[model samples]
Target: MGGEKMLRIVMFPWLAFGHLIPYLHLSNKLAEKGHKITLLLPNKARLQLEPLNFHPSLITFHSITVPPLETLTLPPGTETTADISLNQHGELSISMDRTRPEVESILSTQKPDLVFYDMAHWIPDIASKLGIKSVSYNSVCAISMSHVRPSVLPKAAATSQVALSSSSYVGSVPQWSRNDHNSSVYFGDEITLLERSIISLSSADAIAIRTCREIEGVYCDRVAATFNKPVLVTSHALPDLELQLSPLETRWADWLARFGPRSVIFCCLGSQHVLDAAQLQELALGLEMTGLPFLMAVKPPVGYASLKELLPEGYNDRVSGRGVVHGGWVQQQQILAHPSLGCFVTHCGSSSMWEGLVSETQLVLLPQLPDQTLNAKLMADELKVGVKVERQQNGWVSKQGLCEAINRVMDEDSDISHVVRKNHAKYTSMLISPDFITGYIDNFIKDLQALIS
Candidate 1:
């Protein structure tokens, strides 16, 4: 960029939108600096991301069709975790591995200066053979990336697991992570997630995590040491507050406008992590118990036709004016940015975490998946920017727990509320400061150039 060469970078993220979206945002940032970016993703995702592409002149979308899987039976057009059940994401991981040939061919012909990837662990090996640099770009935080040092796990067929029981699981893994990693939710008949992650981290030339020193400096340093690679943090690449929020449905804007500023709770768990009917009822009752207005966006729980079907008996009738639990996706960024959004009950995905941090809303976490569990810990435990809903030993959240967490943050007089409020504001101010994100991106681009130089 400084009269030096611009790079042609390929972005091949895991099939899930959580992974795909961040990679695309990184691509946009790189492209803005005049680097040519070719993003390889499923056709459907390509279509969905087209509108969000800020640098169409320099960034191109190349769709990769998922090859057939022998061990898994998926309905037609399941390309991402959003398309399948939470536990079935291992199937998606297997499909990503199966695309190695297609990706290799693209790399061979394109011969890009560098490629950024995660989950597709084989990319670094193939890129090295082609004399190309590969950066294992983890869109999640460094904590999950550094959880294992890559040498510990071995790949096994997606058919039957290689058996990592609690007895066999090695050191420092919290009970939540251990339970999660051992569950079918983390792995499938293909290679396990631990293997996919560490293998990629070990082989890649550089490791970039979508985090910052403010939130996860120690974890980032640990990751660099663990992999012996230049581990760089992206400094919150999905800077939604800086970008324009599109008007999704006028009704949401209209409905939200009626509430006083910072008075309504905006609840939207991520695309995955669908609650059961029982849990959905608990969430509904919990928000209702807070006696605050809310807008909750979620799908019907398992076996229920709609969100309406899972409501507690006469639940809607009782909380009719105060709560609205609509089914399906909403423009979460816009919803979070709303003037009326007082509290955000989130799944603590990387995107949601960044968004909540940058916003003025109070953070109340209800994390479901394993990575999300760690993310919740970062905010609720380490950073003390939010309060987490206490869970039963079996990991099910109750209505009372959810209600208490929301009220704790929303309560003006409570000490815990005062702490999270003060801390959340303090960090948010640092994140939005001038040159905060730009400094990281400009320095990161130089680091990338250094790799190819």
Candidate 2:
């Protein structure tokens, strides 16, 4: 290892914004450490990195134009194998067929010192054949990784249930009675995810977790042992942007300004989760019932045409100028940080949770699918900064229940709000700062340079 030595690195991410964004952060961090990076992704994913356009000094984006796979019809806006289940192993075969050539070509020409890839992609072997070290980056929490192993599936199902007492208790995983479905289907998918994960883990030089050991230490230990590698756990590293709102966004801000500090509620279900017609109407009705000044970002999937028709009569007209229902991408971090935003009704994605916590928003978790349930459990149960919306209507979480939860959180007289505010302040202090994350990247590069030396 020597001063000012630069390492050439390449990152290949599956075509999903969640995966692409975190890897971009990692690329930026590495670039800051004097590493040259080549990021390979689809052109559509390029738009997500546009916000970071000013950071051309550190990272380079190289678009890999591959024909879309003919097999496995993907839902609109849904990308990656995690979105659906593979009835057979043939799914991975088709994926590798489409991606391997492009991956190999890049490695052949670039001859990077190291390669980093998403867990789903099977290009670790290609990196090995090229005599290059590589690492695996998982977008989800360690708890999800704990469940990825087949042997641990049964244990996880039982432990996850027993780990939490209720939403009232701290450091406990919340019970999702709805998880009956995830548990039933998990028996098979567990084997599939584990088999693939084992292959990817064995092939990689090391693995990185987008989490801290302080928050998920036990699960991190399980992952490190399962993968048989040095597992490096780092907190989420987001770029410090000088955020400015557009004129339209500024109007939204002005409306928010009307609400006193910690008075307004913000609700958003991340980009991927869409509401059906029935669900959309139910949500609009529920929000109106709460009688709260709320900001909601709604991006229903294309097929859900009935959403507009289903809205309760005059619901939008009644709330006119008081709320904003954005149908497209919104600057989530900026909204979360706004002082008027007192409470958050969220779908409980890890990134969303981190942003809420970082911005000190009182969290009201509504986990939709995938790792979100686990994240909700951690926030409501472990961290105590948030509470889960109580289940009703055969555990479907009806609109009525949604309204009740929002009412409770927005209640100025309740002790829950006071407790939540204090907890958010505590959570922010306990979590590592952005500067600490940058320092971790510096240390990682120093160690990698030592390996080279």
Candidate 3:
């Protein structure tokens, strides 16, 4: 073991924690194999992710200061997607791209064996210049990568943005590419989101997807065909089941303790999935109609200054005992693990999708983004593990549709409920098995080594 070679790897993930956390999970596994890792992220995120660093000595966090936005300066510490709304994402992208010099400085000094990254497509150029191989790690599912090419929304989405109405369309696919980018005032002739991904994947030395054949073999094959590169699977880079659980907040603990086993609904739309005021109230009313105790955590919707102001009139008084609606982020892992939680309504982001599959709760998916839409289809249509809320032609998900999806999974007497429950349980048991994870990760390490060899 001592005589064998050790790899030096650098990790450069996207700005979102959803992306960073999974990259870090991959780092933990690589470090366990005696590999050295340098994790590059925004300066502000370093302290928040410090606790998850299992091997402080082998894996180091290197902060990269994002450049200031040319037109609009963000608050002093706005360093990531979580720091801004969805439409303002383009500004952040400009800042990230401007960090090329800093990243180049870091990469040249380190000269690691491999560079792993997702966004910031120009990484391959830097890696080639430094004589280091680069790998484009897929944080989203292969289905999304294959079928849905993420594109930049109109620049109007930035300034002219308003509350999403019942008639508003957030449908992922055709609409993204359907629009003409010929006349846009965005980062002023900057690359589109889809273009960035394409450039990154096409230019990278290797592709490492955080997925397994069992769940997405066909889609993975499609991705490989599209990119004409071998796609390595890291077994979904699922969070380590053995890691110690973070303590839940006492207020949340005490309130959740009041409910019976598997009797509460937990709905979280991730940190960045914003809904409008009416949408939020409708979702709350849907849960209320379920006549079940619930916990909902969400980001502030457009046009809402605060959660208190965003709520429907009589919302607090009406759903007093049954609902706990929070406006900001929450420890979803802790909440999902609670005994009283039976159902999870999610936005079907990659992390939440994996978490819901592994947890004991049945799923109700309301996917908003493109990647999320495909992920929801995979879970509900392909895996039969959950039910997706029905959307109208205008891409609106009504309160009734949401309530029905939840009831389909939560009603013990319903045959549909039993069917999905059995499938979800069966997959959950297999996915979490220690041997299953080890086999995939072991193969993944060999593949990683192969790339360098």
The lDDT of each candidate is: 0.80, 0.65, 0.79
Residues 1-453 of candidate 1: C-alpha lDDT, one tens digit per residue: 778788899989988888888888888777777889999999999999898888899999999988757557665778887777776676667777778789999999999999988877678778888999989888887776657654454332111111122122322334444434453334534445564555667778888888888789999999888767898777887645446345657988898888899999988888877888888888888888889999888878767778877788898898787789999878887788788999999999888998899889999999877878889999998999999999999878887898899999999899999999999999989887748888888889888889898
TM-scores, all candidates, are: 0.92, 0.82, 0.90
Clash count for each candidate, listed in order shown: 4, 2, 0
The Cα RMSD of model 1 versus the native structure comes to 4.3
How well is each residue in 265-380 modelled by candidate 2, as lDDT tens digits? 78898865666666766666667667777887777544554344556678779887565555667777777777888778899877787777777667788887757888888877
Candidate 3, residues 1-453, lDDT tens digits: the string is: 245568899988988899999998888877777889999998778988887788889999999998776568565567998888876676777788778788889999999989999887778878887888889998888888886332333333322212111112232224332122332323212555555566677777778888889999999898777666778998765656547446878889899999999999999998766887778888888998898999888877877777888777888898898898888778787788888999999999998988898899989999877678889989988999999999988777778988999998999899989889999999989888878877887787777778888
Best by TM-score: 1
RMSD of each candidate? 4.3, 7.5, 6.7
User: What lDDT, from 0 to 1, does candidate 3 have?
Assistant: 0.79
Residue 111 Cα positional deviation in candidate 3, in Å, after optimal superposition: 1.0
Off by over 4 Å in 1: 154-190, 240-242
**Candidate 3 ranges beyond 4 A from true positions:** 1-4, 148-189
Give the TM-score ranking, best first: 1, 3, 2
